[model samples]
Target: MSMSLRRRSGHGARLGAAGLLTFAALAGTGAAHADVAAPRALPAGCSGTSPITCHYAVAPGNYDVTVSLGGAASAGQTEMWVEARRLMLPATRTAAGSVATYSFTVNVRQPEGQPTGQGGTGNPGLNIRFTGSNPQVSAVSVKPAPQPLVAYLAGDSTVCDQPSAPYTGWGQVITTAVRPGAVIANYADSGESSGSFLSNAALFPALLSKIRANDPVFIQLGHNDKQTSASAYRNNLDTMISRVRAKGGVPVLVTPPVRRLFDGNRLTPTALHVNGVGVNLPAEMRAVGTAQRVPVIDLTAKSKALVESLGTSASAQLFLRSSVDGVTDNTHFSQYGATRIGELLLQGIREQRLSLAAYLR
Candidate 1:
């Protein structure tokens, strides 16, 4: 089953395949054959004037999606989302009156409206978003995609996918590093500690329920866990590991990324001082991984090393900064920085020789 819509300045409405066939012929392409649904146009409500998002109903399965952009000007970009998660697409640019096509394979889970405990924002389905001046989408095609191994990321803001520009997380950028046949579902959120994540009704349970056997759940915490006792934080990690294991999922521990805190000429330690003693959060994470016998990604050490190598002025470019906000945040990452950190995470995955490495691009 398929439906299409067209968005114009003052009008928009659902269209049938006949309209899509006309569009295909206009683009000098033949009609779609069996097994390939005709391309769908954006609903009229999705005006081309501003950034518009449109949703399409889809079954709970993997799909290969192809988006054809027509009428693009000098430069433009598009971001595609399956449900709430972003799918990585290569950058595309076109000249006046030209067309550019991008493709990706995504695993679509049941929409949030379903009985799944992973409910959050928006209906469960496919979402297409176009951003930029004169952004135009000519056609969108989705077909059943091959089932691929999945990986889940659970942590704090540092690992989550930030919604807008100037604010990016490693999770969003890491998708580019993941080769075909593997998908990443980042469940990380801001202000979430190890305990809060497990306790959150929508986050961890949703991940646990969907994870299949042998799939890896990458767990990272410590930034917010600093508020709690070291032992308690470790306990939370252990609990998460055990629960994932109970579901036949592989649990991989990841120490949180280092904060860009510089003290004079050296990087500051991420140790929290409690009761006259300093508790090293990353060390605690490593200890927990050892005790639980789970492979740990020592991102703390890796990130700190990266920052020290870049120095103060240069490394500052990695964090969130804006003249308007007048706030320099060391905890979060800008797009460039997030991409670098994402690469580092990829390196860790490769270093450990995790099964997921087979899917790295």
Candidate 2:
């Protein structure tokens, strides 16, 4: 199969092996089957109600999937995933009696090592969840393609996909900036560091097992690693880089984004002090990148520049405010801030001319 794939828009008709799969609403009928083709109605379980999750069983391979929404004048958002791995799609909003479409390519790999039966054995699939008011899913389509160049994100909460509104992560918004052929698999989670991510039983192992040769793994740690010794932190990064390289993967080091700690007019180090160690973590990441010969995305400096340029009162907009999360947090970002950071990362990828750039939309 050719690695190249094209996205088509419009209503209903199926195209080819790689065409649209229209879904019908559940009519209080029987259950939905796995192998059912296009123009099939949604199962009895999935309805037009807000905040409903639907699953589909698909053959294990790489696919370019597109989801379309219709009905209602209200706005809504939907998220798609291949099991735990998230697929990037724009927030869907439609006018009264109009339709909205969002599309992205994803690699659906069979479970390696342990068969958790998350998506069932041998047969892998996609999961879609609708959020917001009056959300309704109209259709979904999938086309087979050659293995995609996957860019996997491994880091902390700042890089993970935020589940709800008011809080968002750069990883979640990056899909919109990425070109069609490449897919991003965000494995980052809240409160994760280099050490914890590798030891977290499922995270690192799952990423390593599915990652193919030439896949790029973007790693950003250091927020939670502050508790860990500098030596230990560097070693953990080294080990991760080595492991990724051993698998024929490319490891790109990303310094953690800066916290919104300000000293009067100037940005200051984050107030997260432990054991009297308040060194600049980005410097450490830079040193590791130099030593390991891996490309580095200096998100720390870029975020700091952005914050400093915005000044104190104005910079607050970039972070989670007390009004939204009930607490002022400089460590995490708001949706606007997350989108900016994601754009910065995408710029870095392009500037570096990484192989993944070829797939950028």
Considering only N, C-alpha and C atoms within 3 Å, which residue pairs clash in candidate 1? 5-42, 12-44, 111-124, 179-361
lDDT per residue (tens digit) for residues 1-361 in model 2: 0111123442222223421111111111111112312233444335546565666676755677666555434433444433433335434444444445555676554441122232223334655566544555666676775677889888878887655556667886666544456887777777777898988766777788778899999999888876677788788889899989999999999988887888887776663222237556678788899998999998877777878889988988888899766768888888778867776786678778898876654
lDDT of candidates 1 onward, in order: 0.64, 0.64
Candidate 2, superposed: residue stretches over 4 Å from native: 1-46, 49-53, 58-62, 70-87, 91-102, 107-125, 130-137, 143-145, 271-276
Model 1 Cα lDDT, one tens digit per residue, 1-361 = 0111121221222334322111122222212212222233564334454465666677766666666665433334444344443535423333445555545556565432122222244556666566544455666777776767889889777777565556677886666445446777777777787888898876788788888889899998778866677778788888999999998899999887777877885776652212123667778888888988999999888888888889988888878776633568888887668767776787788789998876654
How much does candidate 2 score in TM-score? 0.74
Clashing pairs in 2: 18-143, 24-41, 24-42, 179-360, 179-361
Worst 10 residues of 2 by lDDT: 20-29
Q: Which candidate wins on TM-score?
A: 1
TM-score of 1: 0.75
